[model samples]
Every structure is written in structure tokens, then in C-alpha cells.
Target chain A: MINAVKREIPEFIEGYGKVKPFMGAYANIGDVVKTSVKIKSVKPNDKKVLPSIKDALLKCGIKDGMTISFHHHLRNGDYVLNMVLDEIAKLGIKNLTVAASSIFPCHAPLVEHIKNGVVTKIYANYMSGPVAEAVSKGLLKYPAIMHTHGGRARAIESGDLHIDIAFIAAPTCDTYGNINGVEGKSACGSLGYAIPDAMYAEKVVAITDNLVDYPACPIEISQEYVDYVVVVDEIGDPKGIVSGTTRITRDPIGLRIAKLAAQLIDEVGLLKDGFSFQTGAGGTSLAVAAFVKDIMKKKNIKGSFAAGGITGYIVDMFEEGLFKALFDVQCFDLKAVESYKNNKAHQGMSASMYGNPHNKGAVVNNLDVMILGATEVDIDFNVNVTTGSNGIIIGGSGGHSDTAAGAKLAIVVTQLTKARLPIIVDRVTTVTTPGETIDAVVTERGIAINPRRQDLLEKLKDSNLPIFTIEELKNMAEKLTGVPEKIEFEDRIVAVVEYRDGTVIDVVRQVR
Target chain B: MKIVRPAKAGTMESNDIYIMVYPNENGNEIQLDSIVLKQFGNQIKKVIMDTLNELEVENALVVAKDRGALDYTIKARVETAIKRACE
Candidate 1:
């Protein structure tokens, strides 16, 4: 079946079973019902503190084939997922589904669990490194479900994921199960990613490095949702909270692309008073944010709010009064964590409220402009951040599609030819974000505005900022990097890439 | 170019092709490992072989570790390794 993006999708993926082919961005909109059935009455002074993770596991009634969850706010530095999984494996639990929000290179040990028949199913928003490689190679018995950040929240709230146990890595937790991410040694700023898990999961466990006094001050996740509190020596490494290089790019070519993107934003008349924005934490994306910062400062344009996974750069803008508020679903760096701890305007929000379409409304809907990065973008403007050119799962659409669907202008900034391979392609191997939602793609060579955005085209048609048709950009990339041979893949489906609306936009096959 | 010594060129970095040339009894062998082996492997190999043929290095063994280097980069690295191997 062909999806809204025009990509052919299988009706029934091998291990994933049935498929719901993507309709269109904003196509699946309306009233969504959420269900919860856990009924609990805590007696006065009932002990919720557990001696160990094993104890918590036993107390939570974890059994074979139970679904467990963990958040990636701690990112690569997170040890809670591994520690809990190791305990679960040691207990001889089989066929458990791990519903981690994201997977990193640090979670390499998960490959063994998948091979050992202990973990058969997996769900995540983003993934990188060994675990992703193993999934792409079809190690897991069941096909992995890769959802967008908003989709994960929607799935959780709509009872689609139905986590049996949610192990939230709380940087700081009180004896009463009150938790926050900004007060411990492994302080990660926002607990936004884990809020839905705590609220909806059958059993919620708070694993904390810092066991603070009762009624932990400035509580992010209050005591009501948590069912257990387990104290650990360390929850995560604060250093790991910062993913890769977050500094503004020094590469002259990268700077050129970012500058073009910021200029395009200005040309489209989105860079004005009360502009709201979001960007990734990559070097090039940071450069775009930096350029945007300069423009806002120079023009004295105050923004309404900057949202998404908050980084220090975004915090800096907020501190400088460039934006009135910050809506942080997760903190990307320590500086952002510190800012969230002190500033009242540096607000935290749950994943559901951040991008989940089924909720009351998402913060993404209020975004004026958002700068995104793409691994590969096709002529149709469909972006692929889920799989690499080698047909391996290296990343996933965390909030890529959600924000793109919501923002007034969704811009994808990337180099024209990365590592001698063209960034623009005929058809992306996987569609992470549908082209209909994307407005512009900025690269070092040129900027291509989606023809769907005729208004943006009309605004920049006469401007001299290297504006080119999407086809022209593709041709330019092909001139340098010759048309690449398609990567071969086996028929066995490995992972299903679901859009924010919980539809299968693309399926990743095992590499041949 | 005559095979005299074992030499290598280019760093193991993004957008650079690292080539190591050695004297081989088995004439003009190429071993390649690349991130883009699926997409541009043949094109990268052709560039290296063409460069080796242009430099007349018939008996040298070239091992190229390519990280998606362009045709020119692959050619230059192959040429540079051949020149150094002759010394």
C-alpha cells in the first residue's frame, strides 16, 4: 500500500503484523480517548522505598512478556536502563518488551538480551549505535516499533504502548517518591520525557542517585504517580546528558548553510516579535540557532517562546530576554538544567503536552519556525533521519515529524553532499518526515523551498539568496556526488517507522 | 612508480580516503572498507585503480579505507601513496 508520502508499504510486516499506512500530516486529528485502570489506595506510612531494583521488579509483579519503559533524558550517560535490564535478565524474565524512549551507543548490552530471547520486542523514538545495528540485522524476534516523540506520548496516553513498569531515572527523589532532574549529581534538567510513563504505567518506580528529604523541593514529578522509590549510587553521568558536539559549527561551509536558513526565516517574515522557535543540538543546527539569535538581537525582536529539548544556547536566548519563555520537554545540557532550576520561565513540559497530537494541544503547534537536520531529503521533500545510506538504523524521528507538522515554517538544514554522498535523493530509503509538512531545505550549495509552500516561494522569488527549485538542488548534488547505487536490503522487515499520528510511514528492512 | 617501501597517505577522518600501499608479489591488489561501500564502492575503486594505472604502479598493493571521499580525493590519495611506496 502506498502511504501519503507515496512510499509503498507492506500491508503486514513480518514480525510487526498489521500496518496502518500513513495518511497525511494532520490527517489523523480529532478527539482521542485515553484509558487507565490502575486503582490504588495507599495506607498511611506505607513503605514505598525498595531495597534494590530487583526488589522493585519483584514488587511491581514483573513477569514474562511484560512491557517496561525508560526515558532517555540522561542520554548516553544513563545507566538506569542497563542496570534494570541486567536485573530483569538475571531474574530469568523472557520475552519482555523494552519501551525505551530512545536508545544510545551506551546501551550496547541490549543486543545480547535481544539475542538471548529475553527481550523480543522493542519500542523507541530515537536510536543510534550497536542496538540499532543489531535490530537492522534482525536480531530481535519481533520487529522494533520506532515512533516519533509525539507518537510515543500519544501511544502511551492512548493505551497503545501499555507499559507494565516504568523505571524513571530520577536525578533526585524524596522518600515520598517526589522526583526532579535538577538537584542531583547526575542532574539532567527536565523530567518531561518520563512523565507520561509515570502517569499511565501500571507500576511507576523512581530510581534516584540523590535521595532527598521528604517533599523534594521544586518537584517535577510529584509523589502521587510514583509507586516505588529506589535509591542508587548514581542514576546517570551528567556529562552524558550532552549528546555529541553541541557547539556552533566552525566549518565555513556549515556556517554558510545555517546563515542561509536564518536569512530564509527572515525573508519569510517569521523572524519578528513573538516568534517561537526550536532547533536540534547538532553543530550545524546550533549554528542556525546562533544566527537566529544574532538576527533577533540585532532587530530587537522578542520571541514568544523557544521550545523542544532545551539546550544551553536556547537558555542563553531566554536569559537575554530574546524569548518570553522556554518550553523544555527535556534538557540537552547541564547549563540548561541549571537554568531550569533557577528561572521560572524556563518551564518543563511532558512529552504528551510537548508534541502529542491527541492531547489538549502541543507546544509544537505554537512554533513559528523550527530548524531541523536531515540525513537525506528527496525531491518530494520527504526527510529520512531514521536510517543511514547503508540501510542501517542509526537514528529515528524523535520530534522531527511532529514539529514539522506543527510549525509555520519547517526548515531542514544540512550539507549538500555529506561524506561524498548526495544529501538529496530521488526517493529516500525511509521517510521520517513527510514532505507536505516541510517548507524549505537549506544546504551549502543552495536553498530549496517546497513548491507546496507557494507563499514562501512568492516571498523569496526575487530575493538573491541562492533560491533554487528542489530539482535544481538535486541536480547540483548529483553533479558532485554521482547518482548512488541503491543499498540492497532483504525482504525481512526489521523495524517500522511510525509517524506522529501512529501510522507506518516506512519500514526498514534488514541489510543484505 | 616502482614498489620500494611501504607507505600510507591521508588521515582516518570524514571526507578523506586513507590509502596504504605495499610491495605485493600478487600484483596490484586492492582491499577496501568504507562507510559508503554500498553506494559508491565501485566508483571509489575505479578512481583508485585509474590513479594507480596513471602512475604506472603495476606491482603495488593498495589498501584503501574510504570514508566517502570524492573521486578526486580517492585519486589523489592513491597517487600520493604510490609515490611514497616508490621511495
Candidate 2:
């Protein structure tokens, strides 16, 4: 079956089961009836604190084939997922599905679990490192489900994802199960990604390095949702959890593309008062934000809010009064964590409210512009952040599709060519974000406004910045780097790339 | 040009090719590892083989690690390696 993006998908994927081909960007719109989780009571005399993860697992009645969930607030620093999985393997559990928000290089042990049949299936928003490479080689028993950040939250809330147990790596937690990301040694800010898991999972376990006194102040996930609190020697490494500061790109081409994108946004009249923006943590994206800062500061434009993963640069922008408030789904750096703790303006928002299309209104809907990075952008404007030209899983769409669909002006900034390969291709290796949702693509060669965005095209016609059609840009890039040889893949599917609306946009095949 | 001792040219960097040439008993042995192996692998190998042919590099072992180098860069690196190996 062909999805709306024109990618051929099997009606029933071997390991993924039935396919729901994406019809359109807003195809899944309907009144959602949220499912309720099983309720449990904690008596005043009863205790929630546990001695070890094994105790919490036994207390939760965890069994083989149960779906367990984890959040990526600790990022590369996270040890809880591996720590618990090691215990689970020791207990000899089989066929368990790990529904983690994201997977990093630190989760390479997951590859071993996939090989030994301890973990049969996996779900994540983004993936990288050895586990991703192993998945691309068809190591997992089932096809990996790569959902967007918003889609993961939706899947949990809508009951599509039934997490039997959720293990949240809390930076700070009380003996009674109150939890927060701040005020601890690990101290990863914004426990936003873990909220839905805590709210929807059958049994919520709070794994913390810092076990404070009862009634832990600044409770992000209150004690009511947590069933067990386990104190560990360490939940995560502070150095890996948060960076000192994220720097803008120093590459000349990257800076040029960023400049062009920022100029395009300003040209479209979106850089004025009350402007809201979102950008990823990529060097180019950060550079675009830096360029936008200059424009905002020059005109004394007081913007509304900056949304998505909060970074130190964004925190500085908010502190400088460039933006009125910040909507944080995750903290990328330590300064942002500090801002979240002290400043009331740096708000913590759940993954659901951040970009879930089914929600009443998400923070992304209020975004005036969103600058993104792409591994490849096809002539149709469809972006691929999921796979490389060789059709291997390098990364996944964490919030790429969600913010692109919601923002008024979704701009993708990239160098026209990369390492003798063009960033713009005749067709992307995979479609992570469909073209209909993308408004523009900015490359060092020129800026191409999506033909569908005629309003932007007409507005930018008179601008000084170089503007070209996507076809023209592709043609120029191909001139430098001739059309690449087509990549071959095995018949067996490796992963399913789901759109934010819970439909299959594309499927990745095992690399031959 | 007759091959003498083992010699190398180019750095392992983006848009660059690292070429190593050694004297061999057989005609030509070429081994390549490239970033653009999926796409331009055939083109890159052809360029190296053609460049070796032009230099009359018979009975030599050629190894190249390419990080998406252009045709001229690949040719230049191969030529430089051939020159250095002969001296």
C-alpha cells in the first residue's frame, strides 16, 4: 500500500503487524477518548521506598512479555534504563518491549538484549549509535517503532501503547515518591517526557539518586502518580545529562545558510513583536537562533516564547528579555536547568502539550517559525532525518515532524552538498516529515520556499537574499555532486516511521 | 613509472582521499574504503584505475580511503602517490 507521501508500505509488515498508511497531515483528527490507568492506593502507614531495582520489579509484579517504558531526560548520562534492563536480563525475562522516549550510544547494551531474545521489540522517538546500527541490520525480533516525541505521548494516552511498568529516572525524589528533575546530583531539567508515562503506566517507579525528605519541594510528578520510589547509588552522570553551553556553528557554510534562513524569516515579517520560535540543538539550528537574536535585538522586538528543548543560548535570550517566556519539553544544557529552577518564566510542559496533534492546543501551534536540520530534503520538500543515504538508521524524528506541521513557517537549513553528496536529492532515502507540512528549505546556495507556500514565495520575491525553487537548488547541487547510485536493501523491514498522527509515513528496510 | 618503495599522499579529511601505493609482483591490486562508496564508489574506483593506467603503474598495490573527494582531488592524490613511490 502507498502512504500519502507515496512510499510503498506493506499492508501487514512481518514484525510490525498491520500498517496504517498516513493519509495526510491532519488525517487522524477526531475527538479522542482518553483511556484511564488502573488506580492503586497507598495507605498512610505503607511505604513506597524500595532498597533496589530488583525489589521494585518484584513489587510491581513485572512479568515476561510485559511492556516497560522509560524517559530520556538524562540523555547520554542515563544509567537507569541499562541498570534496570541488566537486572531484567538477570531475572531471565523474555520478549519484553522497551518503549523508551529516545535511545543514545549509552544504550548499546540494548543490542545484546535484542540479540538474546530478552527484548523482542522497541519503541523510541529518536535512536543512534550501535543499537540503531544493529536494528538496521535486522537484529530485533520485531520492527522498531520510531514515533515522534508527540506521537509517543499520544500512543501512551490513547492506549495504543500499554506500558505495564514505567521506570522514571528522577534526578530528585522523596521517600514518598514525589519527584523532580532539578535539585539533585544528576539534575536534568524538565521532567516533561516522563509525565505521560507516570500518568498512564500501570505501575510507576521513580528511580532516583537523591532521595530527599518527605514532601519534596517543586514536585513535577507528584507522589499520587508514583507507586514505588527506589533510591540508587546514581541515576545518571551529571556531565552527560547536561552540557555547559551549546555553541553555534563555526562552519562558514552553516553560518551562511543560517543567515539566509533568519533573513527569510525576517523578510516574511515574522520577526516582529510577539514572534514565537523553535529550533533544534543542531549547530546550524543554534546558529539560526543566534542570527535571529541579532534581528530581534536590533529592532528591539520582544518576542512571545521559544519552545522545544530548552538550551543555554535560549535561556540567555529569555534572560535578556528577547522572549517573554520559554516552553521547555527538555533541558539541553545546565544553564537552562538553572533557569527552569529559578525563573518562573522558564515553564515545564509535558510532551503531550508540547506537540501532540490530538491535544486541544499545543505550544507548537503558537510557533511563528521553526528552524530545522535535515539529512536529506527531496525535491518535494519532504525531509529525512531518520536514515542516511545508505538507508541506515542514524537518527529519528524526535520533534521534527511535529513542530514542522504546527509552525507557520517551517524552515529547513542545510548545506547544499555534504562530503561530495548533495543534501537535496531527487527523493530522500526516507520521508520523516512530509512536504505538505514544510514551508521552506534554506541552503548555502539559496533558499527555496515550498511551492505550496506561495504567500512566502511572493513575500520573499523582492528580498536581497538568494531565493530559488527547490528544483533549481537540487539541479545546482547535482551539478557539483552527480546523481548518486541507488542504494539497495533487504526485503525484511527494519523499522516503521510513524507520522505524528499515528500513521505509517515510511518503512526502513534492512541494509543489504 | 616503475614502483619502488611504499609511499602515501593526502590526509583523511572531508572531501579528501588518502592514497597509499606499494610495489607489487602482480599487475594491479586496488582496495578502497570510501564514505561515498554507496553512490560514487564505482566512479571513484574508475578514476583511480584510470589514473594508474595513465601513469603506467603496473605491478603495484593501491589502497585509497576516500571521504567524498572530487575526481580531480582523487586523481591528484593518486598522481602524487605514484610520483612519491617512484622516487
Candidate 3:
């Protein structure tokens, strides 16, 4: 089937049944209701503790081909996924599907499980490191499925991806299974990604290194959703859970791109009283934060909030009274974690509240400006964060498309070329975020506003910064580095990239 | 001209390349290791050879460890290493 974005997709991929090609960026994906697993809770006085991870799995009814879920609040320091999967593999369970919120470098051991057929399928919002490399090489038995942060929540809520058991890595949990991310050695700030899993999965287990007394303070995951509690020696390394600080790029090219992006936001009149903003933790994007903060301070304009993955820079801005509040979905650094735990204005939000398009109102909807990173940007402004220049699975649209669609001004920041391959191309290897939603492309060479945004074109016409058409930027990149040769692919599909609406935007074919 | 001194440029970070140039009797000999070798190995080697030729350094040992750096970054680092080697 040929979709709106012009990618050819089979109606049914072998592993994925009856694939639905993406129709358009904002097309409504009708909702499917779900029935929760019937639970007969233990008496109020009964013990809810489990002895070990293996015993917990055994009680969750370990079997072949059942789906299990995990959250990535611990980021690269996470031990729960590996710990649980190891036990599942040792128990001889095969063909299990793992639905993790995100996969990082530390989870490389998953490649072994895929090789042994203990795990056959994967579903996640983001992936990196050795496991990502293995999937790109077609190591798994079934093609992996990638979704946006909001789409994952939609899928879980609609029962499209039913999780038989969800193992949540809680930083702090009381005897009664009340979980909190603060007040623990491995405090990570917000347990946003785990909320949906705890609420919707058939059985939910809270794994924690810090076991507190009855009634844990400020429960992020309520005891009502938890089926059992397992106290472990350690949940994760706090240092790995949150970086000391997310620094800005010192590279001149990156700095130039970031500066232009911030200026564009100012030109669009987004830097005003009560403004809201979000930016990725990438070097260039963080540089944009620094630039924007300086501008806000210079202009004496206080913002309403800073949203998305909260970094120390954003926390610094809040501490400086640049913004009135911070709507934190997840904290990215120790400073942000400290703010979330102590600051009255820094609030924890569930993933659904953060980016779920189906929700009544998501925080992204209130964003005035959002700065994002892209692996590739086509002439049509379609952004690809899913695959590399060689069409390997290097990343996934965590909130790339979600914020692009929600924010009033969505700016994509990237170098014109990466590794001799031009980032601006006639077409990207995969379309992670459709072109219609993006507002502009900010590169070191120049800025390219989407032609659809005529207002932006007119607004930037008088600005001192160089403004060029998307085609012109592509040409300029080609002049520096010759046009990249087209990449070839095999007939087999290794992974599927889903838009925020859960339709297949593009598929990663085996790179032969 | 021949390289008179040993010098290095770039770092080991991802999306970067580290290069070391040393004076040698061998004619523009190169040693390379890269993460994206299967895809861009030839392009990388071509960039190094072109840079060395442009600088007129015929007798030098060029060693590069790449972490998926692009053409521009590779060119810039190579030029810096060559200049340092000549000094």
C-alpha cells in the first residue's frame, strides 16, 4: 500500500499483522476500549512482598509467548529489564515480546536473548547501543516496532499492545507497594513512563532498592495499581539515572545552528510573558536552551513553564524565575531531580498528560516553541530520527512528532551533513515526523522555513539572519559534500516506525 | 615537504575522528579504523589522501580512529594534524 507520505508498505508484514500505512499527520486513529485484568486483592493486613525476581516471574505465570513490559526511567542505569529478562530466559520461556518504554546502551544483553529465541519481538519509543545495532542487523526473530511516547500510551490504553506483566523499577516503595521516585538513593525525579504500565498491565510489580516504611511519601505510582512489591539490593545507579549536568555544545557549527533557532523563536514572538518551551537534551538543542534563556533574561520576559524531559538547564531557568513552573515528565539530570523533589513549582506528570494526543489536553499543546534534533530532513521538511544515513535503526521518535504537531513553533536543528552524507536530501531514509507539522529547519548554513508557513517566511524576511528555501539548503550541502549515493535495502523488513497515531510511517528493511 | 614532528587532532567522542601524523620514510602511508567502515570507509580514506596531497606531505604516517565523523570534520582534523606535524 502507498501511504500519504509516499512510502510503499505491505498491507500485512509477516510478523506484524495487517499493517496500516500512515494516512496523514493528524488523521484520527479511532480508539479501542479495554477491559482490565480482574484482580482479587489480598487483605489489608496481608504481606505483599515477593522474595526474588524469579519468584515474581513465576507468580506472574511465566509462559511462552506472553508479553512483558518495562519502563526506562532509569535510562542507561536500568537493571530491571536485564534482571527480569535473565530470569525469564533461565526459566526457559521463549518467544516473549518485550515492550520497554526505551532501550539504552546498558541493555545490550538483550541481544543475547534475541539470539537464543528467548525473546522474539520488541516494542519501544527509543533504542540505542548494541541492542539497537543487533536489531538493525536483523538479529531478532520478529521485526521490532517503534512508537512515539504518546502512541505507546495510546496503544497500551487501547489494548493494542497488551502487557501480561509489567515490571516497574521504583526508586522508593513502601511495604504496601506505594512507589515514589524521590527520597531514594536512585531517585530519578518522575515515574511518568511507568504510570500507564502500572495502570493497564494485567499484573504490575514494583521493584525497589529503597524499601520504606508503610505509606511512602508522595506516591507517584499508587498502591492500588501495584499487584506485588519486590525489594532488591539496588534499583539503579543514581549517577547513571541522572547526569550531573547536560552541557551545551562548544562546536562553532552547532552553536551557530542553536543561535539561529533561538532567534527564530524570538522572531515568531514566542519569547514573551507566559511563554512555554521544550527542547531535547542533545548538545545543539541544549545550546538552544542557553541561547533562549539569555534572550528571555535580556528581554525581561518571564515564561509560564518549560516542558518535556526536564534538564538541569531548564531547572536553572526556573530557579532564576525565568519560568513560573516546570511540567516535568522525566528529569534528565541531578539538578532537575532535586527541583522535582523539592521545588513546589516543579510538577510531575504522567506520560499521557505529557504527549498523549488522545488526551483532553497534553502539556505539549501549550508549547510555544520546541527545539528538536533530526537525523535527516527532506525537501518536504519530513524529519527522520528513526534511522541513520544507511537506514539502520539508530533512534526513534520519542516526542519528536508529538511536539512537532502540538507546538506552535517546531524547529528542527541539525548539521547540514553528517559523516559525509547530507542531512538535507530529496527524501529521507525514513519519515519519522511528517513535513506538514514542522515549522523550520535551522542549520549552520542558513534557516529554511517550511513554505506552508508563509507567515514565518514574511516574519523572517526582514531579519538579519540568512534565510533560504529548503531546496537551496539541500543544494548548499551538496556543494560542500557531493550528493550521497542512494542506499540499497533487502526484501525483508527488520523494523517498523510508527507515527504518533500508530500508523506505520516507514519500515526499516534489512541492510544487505 | 616531509613531516618533521608528530602531532594529533580530534577526540574519541562519537561523531568525531582522532588523527595522529608522524614523520616517516614511507610515502603517504595510512592506517585507519572506523565504526562506519562498511558504508563510508572509502570516502574517509579518500578524504585523508586528498588532504595529505593538498598539503604536499609525501612522507608521513597517517593514523586515524573514526567514530562516524563526516567529511567536513574529517578534513578539518586532518588539516590541523598536518599543520602541527610540519611545525
Q: Which stretches of candidate 3 lie over 4 Å from their true place?
A: A29-35, B1-87
Q: What clash count does candidate 1 reach?
A: 0
Worst 10 residues of 1 chain A by lDDT: A237-246
On residues A252-300, what C-alpha lDDT tens digit does candidate 2 reach at each position? 9999989988888889999999999999888999999999999999999
Error of 3 at A459 (Å): 1.8
Cα lDDT for residue A42, model 3? 72
Residue-level lDDT tens digits of model 3 in A1-512: 89888999999988888888898877874454544665557786777788998888888888999999999999999998999999899899999999999999999999999999999999999998888888988999889999999889878877788989999999999988899998789999899988989998988889999989989999899989887899889888776788988998999999999999988899877789999999999899999999999999999998999999999988999999999999888899988898899998999988888888776777888999989899899999999998888778888999898899899999999998776568899999989999999999999999999999999888877899889999999999888767665778888988988887778988988887
- Give the range where candidate 2 chain A is weakest over 10 consecutive residues by summed lDDT: A454-463
lDDT (10s digit) by residue, model 1, range A251-327: 99999999999999998899999899999888889999999999999999999999998888888899999999999
Evaluate model 1 with DockQ and give the value.
Answer: 0.83
Q: What's the chain B TM-score of candidate 1?
A: 0.95
The count of backbone overlaps in candidate 3 is 1
Can you write out model 1's per-residue Cα lDDT over B1-50, one digit (the tens) per residue? 78999999997899998999999886688999998888988888888888
Candidate topping TM-score: 2
In CAPRI terms, model 1 is classed as high
Clashing pairs in 1: none
